[model samples]
Target: MRIAALLGASGATGQKLLPLLLDDPRYDKIITLGRRATGLRHRKLEDRVVDFENLAAGFDGLKVDDCYCTFGTTIKIAGSEAAMTRIDHDFVLAFAKAALAAGATRFAYLSAANADSRSPVFYARLKGRTEEALKTLDFADLGIYRPGMIVAERTDRRWAESLLFPALPLLDKVMIGGLAKFRSIPVETLAAAIAAFSMQRGCGTRIHHWQDMVTA
Candidate 1:
């Protein structure tokens, strides 16, 4: 049995993943740390509202076997690039550090496809840097999931995404070989993949691209 910690249990991906984690027999406990309550009740689930800016103080002494980080935001939603980075980069790293301090040995992070630290794109670069930062923590197992164009019903709507979602399947058919990693994936698939990976006992770091996630 394992005790699992989730950092973004209120988001779309997190919402999908939470039920899977709850049903999985491998995890005996699931602790959710978020700004707001997950509004979920389960015998194995423990929901804790937290201040992301002061995670160490709020979450001190909290320990778990595995930690899943699904927290993220867009520049538009965050109001500016700096704010986006605060959530995507600063908060994520802080959460990882806190989780590590609290005895988490395995970590699973949600990153975007083509996350290059050297990339000029702000989002990609920030995600890449976050990934790089996570590597330095030296967890027993670290899984970075880089999925592209997740298909799901989001609470916060983006017009561009809504318009482009319909064409994703057509685009996916042509995105073969080297471009396979760009193909859109269902949110459920991604959630299952992360859950499966988190339950595994392993060592070293693994990056799961689109192909790996869909197959998992």
Candidate 2:
């Protein structure tokens, strides 16, 4: 049995992944580290409310074999690019480092499509930088999933996203060939793929595109 550490357990993908992790027999303990409670109770679940800025001080007692990160935020919601970077890049690496110190051998991160460290786009550049930083850690296994528009119900509303969400399914059908990676995927499917991939004991780094995730 494995001990798993999860970040962003309250986010859209994280919320969907939490129950799946609990149901899987491979994991004996599922530890969630976040700012607030997941409000979920299970025999194998352990939720730890943490301050991301001071993660090392609070993460000493946790022991995990694998770590999964689904933490993310938009620039609009964060109110500034600096704040968004602190959460999306800085905080994520901080938690990952702490998880490694706790003996985690594998790490999984949910990234976005078109993530490139040299990209002119701010969000994609941040995601790319985060991915690159994780690779420097050199864990036994690292899985970076770059998913396109994630289709899910969100508590925080985005006017533009709300307008586009309904038409994504119809758009997905037409987005074939090279455009397949842009096809929107359900949060549940993405969550399941993350859970399933975490169990694999492969070595080195692997980047899962939209096609790989949907078919996983």
Candidate 3:
């Protein structure tokens, strides 16, 4: 089988996933696209440095079996709500359009746990809108993963999550249902699940919640 693309090949989860994709025999060719070059040197790896918002032209010649999107940003680093939405929602939608035009077989997205298009929170609202847009694409296999508080060692995560980690133990005790026991999952675990689920055939549009990942 031939593997097509990795959209966020430089981010936290994407970094861990790169090695696994390189080592896996299922994919003969791996194409990657991001704002900056990944500087990843491999026989099967083709890295493209371009703006995700304007990927339609850049994606003209690309074809892949699956498009894995682990791309995300925070409001702090993004400087403003508009910028964050641009990267997190607009950019992702652009990539999805390109992928569909290229006739990709599947689209895998990394969305947060509390995503809701009608949510009061702006971040979650954007994620929800993006998820809704992806559903409209009608890909044969559409997988959305909602991971909560991914714990990656030596990651470049924003300071907010870092500050919240210390309180997790106490929070877990008092929190209930999905909010309670909101255990921080490791990045490797999330990436492994993405790889495993992406390989399976015949799965339609499905959303995997936080507990599903913990149990899977």
Candidate 4:
């Protein structure tokens, strides 16, 4: 039996993940922390409202075996680079630290494809930086999932997704070898893979791309 703490339960992928975790027999309890409630109830689920800016205070005393984070935001929604960084980078690392202190030995983070710390792109760089920062926490196992186009119905749909999704099938055919990581994937598949990998004892850090997630 395991105790799992998850952040970002209200997001697309996280919403999918919450039910899976609740249904999985491996987890004895599931704790979800966020700025607001998930409005979800399960026998094994415990939702807590936490201060994203000061996670440690709100997250204290909640011990778990594993912690998974799916928290993310775009620069447009966040309104500024600093604001995006606060949500995507600062808050994520803060949660990892809090979870670690609370006796969590495993941590899982939802990053994105092309997340190179030295990348010229701001979003990729931020994700890469967060991945790097997570490694320093000394979790027994760290799973970083870098998914490409997450295929999901979104309430706040992006124009780019609308433009790109139709072309995704053709792009997937041509995108082979090194570029396969960027291929589009269903959010349900992605969520299942993230849940499976995080629940296991893998040891050290493992980075999952499209092939990694689908194949696993």
Write candidate 3's Cα lDDT for 70-153 as tens digits: 998888779999999889988898888888888787888999888899999998899999999899886899889998788876
How many Å off is the CA of 211 in candidate 4? 0.4
Best by TM-score: 4
List where candidate 1 sits over 4 angstroms from the true fold.
none
Q: What are the per-residue Cα lDDT tens digits for candidate 1 across 1-216?
A: 688899888888999999999998888999888888899889999888888879775466666788999999988899998999899999999988988888888999999998999999988999999999999996999999999889989878788789989899799999999889988999999999998875567747999999898888
The TM-score that candidate 3 achieves is: 0.90
TM-score of 4: 0.97
Residues 39-113, candidate 4, lDDT per residue (tens digit)? 987889888897787888756676688888998988878999899999999999999998888899999899999
Global fold similarity of model 2 (TM-score)? 0.96
**Candidate closer to the true structure by lDDT (higher is better), 3 or 4:** 4
CA lDDT of each candidate?
0.89, 0.89, 0.81, 0.89
- Where is the poorest 10-residue window by lDDT in model 1? 55-64
Q: Which whole-number lDDT from 0 to 100 does residue 152 have in model 3?
A: 77
Clashes of each: 0, 0, 1, 0
Q: Over the full model, what C-alpha lDDT does candidate 3 score relative to the true structure? A: 0.81
